[model samples]
Target: MSMQQFAGGNERFIRRYEYDDSWVIAADVGLDEDDIDVDIVGSTAIIVADTGERVTETEFELPSAGDASIDIHNGVLTITIQK
Candidate 1:
């Protein structure tokens, strides 16, 4: 593999897409559910992961004041927002 392939920490930890009336975010959060915390303050969603070695925090603004549904599967954290 090329050295460039390992850029962005091997892969992007976050993926975001917009729907007609909503937005979806899928993130690679390898930590256990107990180590992950999500919170919506105003129009921003915050994600914090404590992986023993480090603490990673991510935040994104929601499209308007939408509602969000969050879940985790196979170490993937998914958030769907409805407008």
Candidate 2:
């Protein structure tokens, strides 16, 4: 698996990874489950976080269609797309 971190809006960085049967995406936006919102449509995943008074959003495209899951642990927001 390979991961790449790209500079995102509002000075945040989003990380993406590709696996054989899944795609993993993560970010360190310092938000919790109550503060974060995740939306998956078709092959696209959208992650948004409400950091106090500021909002940050990130978008990712998957290689194929799959079930999507989100987890926020230890300050990292992880999204997994499984086929």
lDDT of 1 at 72: 81
The C-alpha local distance difference test score for the whole of candidate 1 amounts to 0.73
Q: Candidate 2: which stretches are off by over 4 Å? A: 55-58
Q: Which stretches of candidate 1 lie over 4 Å from their true place?
A: 1-10
Q: Lowest summed-lDDT stretch of 10 residues in model 1?
A: 1-10
Compared with the true structure, what per-residue lDDT tens digits does model 1 show for residues 1-83? 11111114647567777767777777777766788999888688898989888888877776566688888887877878786
**Top lDDT: which candidate number?**
2
lDDT of 2 by residue, 9-77 (tens): 566678889888888877787777888898888888777878889887767776667788878887788
Per-residue error (Å), model 2, residue 83: 3.7
Task: State TM-scores per candidate.
Answer: 0.70, 0.74
Q: What does candidate 1 score on TM?
A: 0.70
